[model samples]
Target: MSEVVLITGGSSGIGKSIGELLTTKGFKVYGTSRNPEKYKDSLFPILALDVRDLNTIQQTVKTIIEKENRLDVLINNAGAGITGPIEEIPEAEIKANFETNFFGPINVIKSVLPQMRKQRSGLIINITSIAGYMGLPYRGIYSASKGALELITEAFRMELKDFNIKMTNVAPGDFATNIAAGRYHAPILNDSPYQKPYGNTLKLMDAHVDKGSPPNLMAEAIFNIINSKNPKIHYKVGNFMQRFSIVLKRILPDKLYEKLLINHYKL
Candidate 1:
C-alpha cells in the first residue's frame, strides 16, 4: 500500500508543487483547499477545508483515514501572509492571523496525533518561514505566527519522539509566490503613528520578492527532505539573503543584528 499524504493549502503555490511531486513519488497524495472547486485536477483527491475550523479539520482527517486506511504524512502547508507592523494591525486581525497560521496547524497536529500514534509512525511537515526565526520589521504579525509555529514544531518533535512520529519544520525565505500579490486576505491594520515604517518595510519586501527564488527550488528541497533516511527537524533553503540572515543571526550581537536588519529593510 502506498503511503497516504495529506497536504492542506495544496491548491497552488508551493503546496500545489509539493502535491504534484509527491504524487510522482508514488504517495497517495491528497490536497485540501478552502475552495475545492479551484483544485480541478483529477490526479489527486481534493477536499474542502477551511483551516480555521476545527470541526472541518477533524472531519477531513477522519474522511481521509477512513478511505485511505492509513495516514502516513500530514503537511501543514496552509498559511497566510499579513504584511503590516504589529501595532498597526487591528486586534481582530492579529487574533485572526494566530487562528489561521498558528492555531490552524495546532488543530491538525492534535487531530492527526491519535491516528499517528495508533499507527506508531507518521511524518508531520510544517511549512514555516525564515521570519519564524527572527524579527522582520514590516512583517511583525506574520513573523509572530511563524514564531509560534516554530515552538509548536519543537514541542511536537520532543513529545512525539518515542511514538516514532517525526515533526519537521521547513523554513524557506522569500519564494516566488502570490503571497505578496495584493491579495484580499489581510488582518486589520492599526492606525498607529509608526504605521509608516510598516509601509516602507512592505515596499522593501515587495522589491526583494521580485527577485526572490522560484517556488520550484523550495518544492525540490522539500522532496529531498521527505526522501532522506533521517529527516532533519528543521530545513532552511533559498537565496543568499536567508543564508546571510542565519549567519548574521549567529555571529552578530543583538544590537548589531537589529541594526543590520533595519538598515537592510529601511532601504
Candidate 2:
C-alpha cells in the first residue's frame, strides 16, 4: 500500500507544491487549509484545518487516521511571516506570529504523535526557515519563531527515537511564494527611529522573495527525505549563499558575522 501523508498549509505555496509532487509519486497525500472550499481542484484532498485551533488540529488528524488506518508521514508546513523592527512591532502581533509559526506546529505534532506511535512507523518534517538560523534586523520576530521550532525538532527527534518515529527540520531560504502578501508588516512610522533602515530593509526583503528560487526546490528536497532509510535530523534547501550563511555564522566571530549582515542589509 502507498504511504499516507498529511501536509499542513497545503493550499498553496511550498505546501501545495510538495503535495502535488508527492501525489504524482503515488503517495496518498492529504493537504490542509483553513478553508478547504477554495481549492476545489487541488491534486490531492484539501481538508479544513487551522493549525492554531487545537480542536481542528485534533479533528483533522483523527479524520486522516480513520480513513488511512496508518498515518505514515506528516509535514508541519503551516507558518506565517512577520517583518518589522523588533522594537516597533506590537507585542500582540509578535505573540500571534509565534502562535502560528511555533506553537501551532507543536500542537499539530502532538495531535499526530499518538497515531504515529500506534503505527510504530512514521516521519514528521517541520518546515522552518533559513532566517531562523540568525536574527535579521527587521525580521527578528519571524526568525525567533521559526528558530524556536527548529530547536524543538531537535529535542523531539531524540524523544521519539525509541518509538521508531523520526522527526526533522527542513529550513528553506526565500522562495517565490505568496508568503509576502500574507506576512504582517508593521507599518513604517514616519517619526520612528528605525524608519529609514527598516524601510530599506523591507524593500530588499521583498526583492529577495520576488527573485527567490522556485517552491519546487523545497518540494523535491522533502520528497527525498521521505524516501531515505534514515533521514538526517536537519536539512536545508536554498541557494549557495543562503545555505552558506549558516556556515558563516558558525565559523566567523560574532561581531564579524554581525558586520556582514549589517553590510548586506545596509543597516
Q: Which candidate is the best by TM-score?
A: 2
Q: Each candidate's TM vs. the true structure?
A: 0.93, 0.99
Each candidate structure's count of clashing pairs: 4, 0
> Which 10 residues in a row give candidate 2 its minimum summed lDDT?
112-121
lDDT of predicted model 1: 0.83
lDDT of 1 at 207: 80
Best by lDDT: 2
Candidate 1 wrongly placed segments (more than 4 Å): 182-192
Runs in model 2 lying further than 4 Å from the true structure: none
Evaluated against the true structure, the overall lDDT of model 2 is 0.96
Write candidate 1's Cα lDDT for 115-213 as tens digits: 999999899999998988897776778888998898888888888999999989999888788778733233334666665666676677778777788
User: How many backbone clashes can be found in candidate 2?
Assistant: 0
Per-residue lDDT of candidate 2, residues 87-120 (tens digit): 8889999999999999999999999899889888
